[model samples]
Target: MQTEIIVAGFGGQGVLFAGQVLAYAAMDHGLHVTWIPSYGPEMRGGTANCTVIIADEEIGAPLVKHPKAVIALNRPSLDKYEPLVTAGGLLLVNASLIDRPVAREDVQAVYVPANEIAERLGDKRLTNMVMVGALLGATGVLEMNAVQESLKAHLPAKHHRLLPANYQALEEGAQIARETLAQAA
Candidate 1:
């Protein structure tokens, strides 16, 4: 199985970090993974997107022109990357920031209030984790428990104490996904 994902948003939205964590989690699951980030001037308030490729076999390319999944944290991200997602793939949008919905029918568009959830969790920085949760729940790429374990491995020693918060954020995001999907169904 091959999974390509693009996490795109503004510069400070942790788009790159989200890709890194997903890549790391894929690697931990014994899959080949590659992460590519658009940096420098392109990251300044514009569409800062990172591509993560995970495959059971060798990955041919790291750049994802068309991804199997897209996590768009902002309106610009959705407007920019929504078309690139493959048919029957997954699209996770930050509903808190985007007003319009995806018009595509081939893919599943999941709306998650990641930023709002992070704010309610008392640390807006956990928006990335919240999106991670939605991604996990929507695509079943990684188990929730495995994601929690990966968080411990990914966070630095200085920020180790915040592991609990991140875990909670992820769980909350996943729960939101579940509820939203249920309502949509």
Candidate 2:
């Protein structure tokens, strides 16, 4: 199983962190993975993005021209990355920050209210976690248990208190996807 994903947004939106968490989950799943982040001038600004590859075999390239999934956190990100999603891929957008719809029928696009959900959870910074949850629920790439464990390992010790809240954010995200998709179906 090979899956390529792009997570992109402005700098302060935690796009990289979301990629890192997904990468960590892939690692914990014992899959060969590579995380290639956009470097140089783009990193200086909030326009951060990364490509993550998880596969059962050696990855041929780290640069993804087409990805199996996309987590777009802003309008610019959605505009830039939405076209790159492959047929039957997943696109999880931060609907709270971006109010656009995917223009492709080849992909399954899910709009997540990350900022609103995070705020409701009492932290406006768990947007990444919210995206994480939607990604998991939408794609089923990793087990929820693996994600929780990865969070525990990836988060700093001082921020242990956030583990539960982060988990909550993730669950809320999943629920949102479940409810919305169910309704659509």
TM-scores for every predicted model: 0.93, 0.94
- lDDT to native, each model: 0.86, 0.87
How would you encode candidate 1's per-residue C-alpha lDDT over 90-182 as one tens digit per residue? 889999889999999988888888888999988998998899899888777778887788778978989998888899988888888888777
Q: Residue 181 error for model 1, in Å?
A: 3.1
Clashing residue pairs in candidate 2 are: 10-46, 11-46
For candidate 2, the lDDT comes to: 0.87
lDDT of 2 by residue, 1-185 (tens): 88898999988888888888988988988888899899678778669999988898888898879899989989998998888888888889899989778888877889898999999999989998899899888766888889999999988999999899999999988888777678767
Best-fitting candidate, scored by lDDT: 2
Pairs of residues clashing in candidate 1 = none
Best by TM-score: 2
Evaluated at residue 92, the lDDT of candidate 2 is 90
Q: What's model 2's TM-score?
A: 0.94
